[model samples]
Target: MAIGGVTIFATLGYFALYSNKKPEASAKDVAKVTAGVAKPGNTRPR
Candidate 1:
């Protein structure tokens, strides 16, 4: 039971660390795509 509890805490800690690191490249890509589609040429939101 003690080992299982430690494993769960370790897993949670790993995810906590992972979530803190945001992907800046993906954000830039999304902004580029949004800017392109938001232009007057493309009125429909995809």
Candidate 2:
């Protein structure tokens, strides 16, 4: 049980330190992604 607790804590700490560290997307990158998703047959009616 103690080992399990340590493992959980370590996992949480790793993510806490590393997660959400990505650089913010630039407008060009956003537009490229949007364009890919908007290509033919990719759209679904909402």
Candidate 3:
């Protein structure tokens, strides 16, 4: 019983440390993707 509890705790700890829920993205990146401002070889100040 004790070993089982320890294994469960270790698994939880590993998941808590390694899991990535939200990715990092800047506002500009999001905005650019949302608005069809420019395509390849095109640049615009928005």
Candidate 4:
């Protein structure tokens, strides 16, 4: 039971650190996606 608790905490700590250190998506990429809405064709997804 102690081993399982440690494993769970370790996984949670790893994700916490990973998320804090993760890179954000670039503005260009964000703009590209936003610009897709302006296209003349049907915008609604099937």
Instruction: After superposing candidate 1 on the true structure, give the runs of residues whose Cα lies further than 4 Å from its correct spot.
Output: 22-46
Q: What is the C-alpha lDDT of each candidate?
A: 0.49, 0.47, 0.48, 0.47
Residue 40, model 2, lDDT? 32
| Cα lDDT of model 4 by residue, 1-46, tens digit | 9999988876665555445441553333333344443332332232
The predictions' CA RMSDs to the true structure, in order, are 13.2, 12.3, 14.2, 13.3
Model 2 residue 32 lDDT score: 38
lDDT of 1 by residue, 1-46 (tens): 9999988876665555445544542433344443444353333233
Which residue pairs come into collision in candidate 1? none
lDDT of 2 by residue, 1-46 (tens): 9999988876665455344333453433433334444443323222
How many clashes show up in model 3?
Answer: 0
In model 4, the clashing pairs are none
Q: Which of 2 and 3 is the better model by lDDT?
A: 3
Instruction: Name the regions of candidate 4 deviating beyond 4 angstroms.
Output: 22-46
Instruction: Point to the candidate with the largest TM-score.
Output: 4
User: What does the lDDT read for residue 38 in candidate 3?
Assistant: 33
Best candidate according to lDDT: 1
Error of 3 at 12 (Å): 0.3
